[model samples]
Target chain A: MSFEISVSRRLGQGVIALDMAGGDGITALFGPSGAGKTSILNMVAGLLRPDRGRVAVAGRTLFDGDAGIDLAPERRGAGYVFQDGRLFPHRRVRANLLYGARLATPEARATGLDIALDEVVAFLGIGHLLDRWPRTLSGGEAQRVAIGRALLACPRFLLMDEPLASLDAARRDDIMAVIERVRDEFGLPTLYVSHDRAEVERLATRIVAMPQRDTA
Target chain B: MSSFLALTPDDWEIIRLSLKVSLVAVALTMPIAFGLAWVLARLRFPGKLLLDGLVHLPLVVPPVVTGWLLLLAFGANGPAGRWFADWLGIEFMFRWTGAALAAAVMALPLMVRAMRLSIEAVDPRLEGAARTLGATRWRSFLTITLPLSLPGVLAGAVLGFARSIGEFGATITFVSNIPGETRTLPIAIYSALQVPGGEEAVTRLAIISVLLSLGALIASEALSRRAGAGRGGHVL
Candidate 1:
């Protein structure tokens, strides 16, 4: 088991809960629009605090409500690829891609798990866009750079939230190929969140459907 | 008018002192203003409203009242003044330093407001993105937030500098008009007005003051435009 999540949170007037333990591959949290799929990913990334639960990824306890142990987002080392790419507008593409490497701790750097910049750049096919600013990139190019950035962070696990929701069909195919290579080559455990059943079927090794909530 | 325009050595000294005091005051106030603005823009806590009000109080209250408050806290025998004197051997009582301090207080509100608006314009989500990429909060702020808000910071500095140069009531009240020390441009103009046959000198000094303020205003405008352009033409 590479991921364990049993968490409940109060969102507005309702409660959202999830309980799952999955293998060391891409486990997709498949659900409808308001079923709290993104919320689960947020909890795993340490962005949203769970009201009560435990989140362990790859033998590391990221959050334990009973033990009063909740790590900060930076300490969690979860590479989160947001829906909008969220690239730094002020940084050039090269700087954006290298941001994670620049921020890695000395101990993490010494561990030899650090992904090479050239290899990732070549793998993602983003070498041509390196000098350009984020504002100048197309949706597909920006998403590719965003993925490269997350990989360079040396994350313990991956949390992706609807990363292809905005791209057109052609761009989606390109990014889908990239995600496939990242999963096969990097071998990092991933918690993928999406509403598109086709995307989940194609990429996910196992599917965990979100529990239905009372909309009334 | 021509004779009046011919600046005397005393007038030159006053202009030089004014420039020095305002520059030092802005340089000192900028980092403090940016810190406060960030707190107000990004943090949510109890008494935030009270803190915001306190920072803007100088802009609303009479400058004389601000000077009086400064005197009570930073006087020679006051706590901050006494500590500085004991440890750093620096004094603020009736010195040019006191004048600069008064100007800084008056300029704080403008500087903080400008910086706060710019900081608020940056999406908090970007910082979150940086954090998930192994960046500590401080690193994200320095790398993402600071660079994005550079224009506003520069504009705030210029605005504060303009305000500092025009400072009069607080300066006159805190540090008496000491010649060659605290007698900045505005104070010199006031002093010249009291003497007979000093109208020409006053006119010249007033014109110079106006020109300096106009220059600062134009520079801030240019910086704001650049800020908008850099942010993909978003009207900041």
Candidate 2:
């Protein structure tokens, strides 16, 4: 499915104007720390409402300012993985994985929990960590689990916000491989945010740059 | 020594009453504190500053003044009190329920403050992550926000309970110190101090109060440390 996003927002210290549109492939949002890359992903995920813009994924209007249509993040069907894993600390890994599945509508449950859970776990190679707590996982392992948790939600598109920024170079490579595999295997559109040009070059099929805002 | 041994019944009753009052206070204020903390930490509304100030007003107001306000709002013949008594047969004035209400009011600010800090400490990005995972706002809070903020919520409860256990001005002004009714440990201690040769009884009660407060503080610190360790050594 295709994903189209054009958003303009006034963030911390400047205005962020982002205009981009792409189809089923990894679209890299590349820029410096404050270049509004994350903001654009957030807009697409419906986490941040743009002052003026339209976000459409696969011809479905997720947000249209003039049309007064703004779907909440949950209804947008976009999988988002944050830089930090942000896993539920109190829940076991298995419980955290099922959290999203539990929120699925009744119609979505016909697919069966065991099938979805096993598929995500096998795909992410986190089968052994299911009973473990989030605190027990390394940086790379946690990110993998985070990705698995997001995918289990059955999203139409994936929005990743600097998911590899916190890992070491070796760990970054490891998680990067998983990300690419997911993108290719699922055949779903992916939007990745990153400051590393090498990562963008390696993973992204399309590049969207967010310009830095002027301080004065 | 004989008098102290003879008052065992009174001592047990006071201790039991204190625990009951603190537990009720903590229970009554927990959900409210959670709701307020979420609003303060996550959403930015027009009157947010005013609401924040109001939530914290009890902390700055003298306990006696707070007790007076509660009496005016919930005493017999008062608007809410009269309606409650007429409709639900609930009377709070000069009763154990009144003591719990006073303690809850006194303890609310500390509860909200601790919870607010912890909720604010949580990464908003995580909530965003939960949202993208098909969890609605309320669901996201229940699954992600609440669990992640558990340490802080526990700390808030312990702090509130400790504060309630020691609450004096408000409890006395609102409920009065009636044995087997509204008299908590602190109230009992205060009463013991009023009589001749009551020094020894006061000393024993004082020691118990100190131990309980210290225990709560230690528990809260341990919980916070565990939460921090769970987050990969990052203190949230």
Candidate 3:
């Protein structure tokens, strides 16, 4: 899917403006912490509303300030994975993976659970962890499960917020491989947040750099 | 000893009435406590400070004063009580229902505080994750927020139950100690202490009170531990 997001939001005294467009591939938002990388992803996920701008995903207007159109997060069709895997602690791995698929509209669910499950399981190699509790999984394993859970949602775009940040060096390398495989196989447009330049070089098809805000 | 051992018909009535009032109070207050706790922990809106203060008022105010206020608002000739009598043929003054109302008021703060802390501890990022996965606000709350806060909810319920079981001043002031209708375990104990021959009976009731409170605390601890274990052996 192709989309463009041009938005401006106030941060403290200054405004953080974002203008970007890309087709189907991983677009890395590279910046140090507090450089508004996560803010851009939040806007894309409909978690934060832009002060003035438009967001369109695959020709669908998600937000348009003049038209007064703002779709809620759920309606945006973007799967989001947080820095910490936000797996439901009470639910088992299978339940967490199936949550989004179950809640999807009938037409969306028509893709079939088995197909989605098989694809995500193979893509992220989380088949073994299906029955285990989220807490039992290692950091890398948990991140794979989180990614698989998002894939089951069958999102138009995947928004990853520093998904590899919590893992150790070796674990980050392993999980990044799984992420790259999923992105290529699914052919889904992804907005990846990261501070690591090597990660961006290895995974991103395009890069958007954000710098720290200056204090006067 | 014989008197304490004998479970008289009136004693049975007091036992049943106490359970009835406490159960009703706990049931009625759970949803309200959950809502108030969520708002306090998650939302930033105008009047939030006032709402926070109001929810905590029962904790700080004397229970007797709270009962007095309820009596003024729901007494026979009072606005709400009069309307209830005229329109619904219901009365709260000196009734078991009034005892339940007082218990609910007294337990509200404990419930809200436990739930608020739990809700606050939940990762907002998780909710954001659910939102991206096509969950509406209410659905996310039902499936995600509510489940994650289960330990807190259980803790709140247990605390409320303990508070309700031991409630005395407000309950006595609002509903009085009608032996078969409004008298609860605590009231029974208090009454027994006032009589010359009721010393043993008071001891029995006191023992029962202690046992029940201890049981509730143990149950809460066990529940929290189980929940934490389910989340991968990390205690919340």
Candidate 4:
């Protein structure tokens, strides 16, 4: 399995129990809004810890309650693009893209993506947007830069949490194309979260439905 | 311009001393205050409430009380003050440095409050986003939280500087008014007010003080607004 996650964590007063495994291409977490889809992604990314369970990606144990193996988010190398496109507003697009690349681990540099920063930039068609700040970019353009930034990290896997939710249909298609291209060329598994069946149908190779959990 | 204020060396020195003292106080307090504000904004320690209360203590306490506390902690006979004098040749008793210490203490609460408000306003999601992109906690803070909070930092510094310039009771109590040393513009005006037929001198100095404070406020406001325009704003 490229990704194996069986975890339970509390959200306020309720518990979110997720158990799933996947291999290859985009594994879409299909569900309605607030079904803890984003929570699963957060656990895989090591941004949230599970109360008792193991999360292993490509045989690298990211978190294991039994073995006491919990890596920091930075060490996990699982890139995550938030729904709202949390690009650093004060930084220019180029700087935001270079943030992870500048801090790339020795292991990351050994990957095929070592010199692919320029390639990613070209692929995302963000060269024209490089000098501008995030506040100047449209939602579609910002989403592209956000994806480009995560790719520059050479992450073990990519977790995209409804990256197209905030865009119009046309703009959503624009970002969807870039995401498809990244999935094809980046050589990493992508767990795409979404509530829309059409979006998942268009993007996912294999689908795992998120059981609607009560957040109350 | 009055003949008493025709660029007289004494008048100019007073203005220069006030600027120097206030600037030095701001410089000394900025980094420390930023650290304190960030901690207060981000962390939740056991004594966090107590620390917050202590920081704002100077704001509520009388200026003279703060001056007395400074004198107790930083006076020549005090352990910290004596160690400084013996080891580093630094003295705070009745010196210009002492005036700066007083001003910094008085201005710290304002700086910390402004910065904390700005820091709190920053989206924590940005820092979390940064962390997932291979940035450590410190790295995320420097890249995301710190830069996004710049407007607050600048706002705090400007507020601190303005407060330092206007500080009088704490400064005079701690450092005492001395010619060409601890005697800043406020002290000069006060001295002029006490003397018979020194009305013109007092009036000229008071005008300069008002202008300086107003100018600083205006400049800082503009800069803060520009800095804040970046965050929490809708993109086209």
Q: Judged by DockQ, which candidate is best?
A: 4
Instruction: Give lDDT: candidate 3, residue B73.
Output: 82
lDDT of 4 by residue, B107-128 (tens): 9998898788788878888888
**Ten contiguous residues with the weakest lDDT in model 4 chain A:** A108-117
Report the lDDT tens digits of candidate 2 across residue range B65-144. 98888889899968988988999898998899999988898888888878887887787777777788778888887777
Residue pairs in candidate 2 whose N, alpha carbon or C atoms collide under 3 angstroms? none
lDDT digits (tens) for residues B1-236 of candidate 3:
57666776766677778778888999999999988998899999999999999988988989889888888988887898898889988788888888998999999988888778777767787788888888998999888888888886887877788889889999899888888777899999999999999977777777777888788777766665654443331222
| Residue-by-residue lDDT tens digits, candidate 1, A1-216 | 889999999897678899999887799999899888888888998888999999998888999999999998988888889899999998899999889888888765653247889999999998999999999999999999999999888787788899999999999998998999889988889999999999999999999998875444
- The worst-scoring run of ten residues by lDDT in candidate 2 chain B lies at B227-236
Report the error of model 2 at residue B84, Å: 3.1
lDDT of 4 by residue, A1-216 (tens): 888889988887677888999898999999988778898888888888889999998888999999999999988888788898899877899999998888888887675255466888888888999899898899999999998898888787889999999999999988888888888877688889999999999999999988868565
- lDDT (Cα atoms) of all candidates against the true structure: 0.88, 0.83, 0.83, 0.86
Give the alpha carbon lDDT tens digit for every residue of B1-236 in model 1: 57758888988899899998999999999999999999999999999999999999999999899888888788987888898889988788878888899999999999998888888888999988988888888988988899988897898889889899999998888887998889998999999999999888889999999999989988877776777665542222
- TM-score of the second chain for every model: 0.94, 0.92, 0.90, 0.93
In model 3, what is the error at residue A152, expressed in angstroms?
A: 1.4
TM-score versus the correct structure, for each prediction: 0.92, 0.87, 0.92, 0.92
* Candidate with more favorable, higher lDDT: 2 or 4: 4
Question: Which regions of candidate 2 fall more than 4 Å away from where they truly are?
Answer: A106-115, A211-216, B1-7, B228-236
- By TM-score, rank the candidates, best first: 1, 4, 3, 2
